[model samples]
Target: MYHVHLPKLEQMGLIEPSGNWYDIRRGPRFDEIEPLLRVIDDHRKKLPGDVL
Candidate 1:
């Protein structure tokens, strides 16, 4: 995930990696997906077990 997922998300402006490479923070575009994440969390129990 360090080489694949993290870089992909970073490229999309969804996550920002720390200078030391040991931490991460929300990127500028995080707001774009925040609503979707909230909806998913709100209905997580109703979703299929494997969906998450």
Candidate 2:
């Protein structure tokens, strides 16, 4: 399921791929404590500056 959305998200500007790395676009909405904070949010966060 998740593997299927990767390309779509990339094309939508939500994610950018570079070799084995990916960068996510950040914005005010990205920090919302609700949509992303909810356990039911459906996905986990992958910050650009996070240590892999």
- Residue range with the least summed lDDT across 10 consecutive positions in model 2: 24-33
* Cand. 2 TM to true fold: 0.34
Model 1, 1-52: lDDT tens digits are 2477888889999999988456899999999999999999999999987898
Question: In model 2, how many backbone clashes occur?
Answer: 0
Q: Note the residue pairs that clash in candidate 1.
A: none
Q: Which candidate comes out best when scored by TM-score?
A: 1
| Clashing pairs in model 2, backbone N/Cα/C closer than 3 A | none
Clashes found in each candidate (C-alpha, N, C closer than 3 A): 0, 0
> Global lDDT for candidate 1?
0.90
Q: Which candidate achieves the best lDDT against the true structure?
A: 1
* Reference-based lDDT, each prediction: 0.90, 0.50
